[model samples]
Target chain A: ETAVFQTPNYHVTQVGNEVSFNCKQTLGHDTMYWYKQDSKKLLKIMFSYNNKQLIVNETVPRRFSPQSSDKAHLNLRIKSVEPEDSAVYLCASSRTGTEVFFGKGTRLTVV
Target chain B: GQQVQQSPASLVLQEGENAELQCNFSSTATQLQWFYQSPGGSLVSLLSNPSGTKHTGRLTSTTVTKERRSSLHISSSQTTDSGTYLCAIAASGSWQLIFGSGTQLTVMP
Candidate 1:
């Protein structure tokens, strides 16, 4: 069973369109993270949220933003998506200094 | 710069064979975890070893904090074990995890 849930397992959208992916965790972890896996299978950390406060923000484009309504939920919104944005987005959460639980991931395809 | 590096970008093994994967980090890690991703893209936590050795079923993980390195050993590899193995480390005082480029394993019968 998965403790982290991501909706819209796969999404396909055209360029310049806005898209949003939702993620929720039932693990009661205080820290959550978003990572992007590119075509080369390299995972890159995009954002980290601790107790609903932004902690680590990588050098991601301004078009990408993380929205957290509560500690259990973190949603990703991409504005004017581009072709290069096509990749698998993973959501993970963990308690401070512990192993993280990850969602199955949302694969986004920009055409 | 990549903080974590995984050796042998890809590996192939026959059923019943043993496989070893390595992960080296650039800094001291407070938490180190090994994860397996199936071909379908689901992530499963295999082991978490900051230091010392830990085992689960056919999988064994050994971490040497002093050397900032870790290794995962799979005994009696099976066709079902064919997938990607990823190593992640959380630096001391950091809330985020740095992931190493996964090592893809292919087990054939």
Candidate 2:
């Protein structure tokens, strides 16, 4: 019973293809984030949305975009995927200045 | 340029042994959290202590905001505890969190 839900636990796509990951949180949190875990298991923040508004964009590449329909949903879109984009993308949500709950993560493999 | 450093990149412990993980941040944090990721890649929230000592079951967390450091202690470790423990912090006035590389723990039975 995860409060945060992510779709397509795993994805494999061609280098030039585009991919999107969907995330939904039922915890009613105001802040949602997208994090990327590299091959070395290093987690880095890619984007943050507060109440459906983008608040932080950590210098991510222009092809990477975050889409939020509402506060409870924050999805990640990567256009023209590259081999370097292969990694685990995790979705998390939390109240401002509080603990965060993360999804199981979507593993993307760009071949 | 905020950074989070975790010590002892990996640790192995026998069942019933204790383990301690450390985290140091480069800037003042408005929120500090400890998260556990299972081998299957599911992340679970362990503790959230910004500037004080807190405990839950066999886990204890202590954060000294003045020193920008925090620690998580797991007592009576079990094989089920084998996973990666990550420390993350959100700098004051910031909404994004910076995560440490994480400390991988293996509890052997």
Candidate 3:
């Protein structure tokens, strides 16, 4: 049972192109986060949104941006995609100071 | 900055054997969570124990906040339990979870 959902289970795009990944959570959690998992299986925090306000923005590349409409949806957009962007983008949700749940994740391949 | 470290980077066990994975953190943590990552790239949250001990099914998680350490015990291991186990910690007044590299477990029949 997945309360946190992500779109386009897999995506392949070319360099210099733009890509967007969509995420939604039915858990009614006030906090949402986007994490990047590299080929080495290292998970890195990218951005966190709480109650529709962007918070905890890590030092990632400028190409990455998070968009949200209300508290249930958070979307990630990347411009001029790079090979390094070819990894799994995981969307997660949680209540403040509580357990966090993750979605299946969207696999992005930059060709 | 908070850091989470997991020990015994990799482990192998026979079916029915119990396995224990350890986690240590550098700062005060108000929340702790364990996650399992399948080889297929899917992730599942196993348990979230900020302190003391908690159990669900065959998995048990124990966290010592003052000591900044946690341990995950998997009882009666099965081949289906083979995957990577991740430990994460969130410091007080913060919502970000600092994750460890994870411990890979292999269970043989």
Instruction: List CA RMSD, all candidates.
Output: 1.1, 1.0, 0.9
Give the native contact fraction of candidate 1. Answer: 0.82
How much lDDT does candidate 1 score? Answer: 0.92
Per residue, candidate 3 scores C-alpha lDDT tens digits across A1-111 of 899999989999999999999999999999999999998898888999987668755578988999999789999999889998999999999998899999999999999
Error of 2 at B41 (Å): 2.0
Please provide, for model 1 over A49-93, each residue's C-alpha lDDT reduced to its tens digit, 9 standing for 90 to 100. 887578656589999999999999999999999999999999999
Q: What is the lDDT of residue B36 in candidate 2?
A: 93
Tens digit of lDDT per residue, candidate 2, span B1-109?
8999998899999999999999999999999999999886688999989989999999999999999999999999999999999999999889788999999999999
**Residue-wise C-alpha lDDT for candidate 3, range B1-109, written one tens digit per residue:** 7788998999999999999999999999999999999897688999999999999999999998889999999999999999999998888888988889999999999
lDDT digits (tens) for residues A20-41 of candidate 2: 9999999989999999999999
lDDT of 1 at A32: 87
* Candidate 3 clashes between residue pairs 3 or more apart in a chain or in different chains: none
lDDT of 1 at B8: 82
Give the Å shift of residue B14 in candidate 1.
0.9
Worst lDDT 10-window in candidate 3 chain B: B89-98
- Kindly report the TM-score of the first chain in candidate 2: 0.95
Worst 10 residues of 2 chain A by lDDT: A51-60
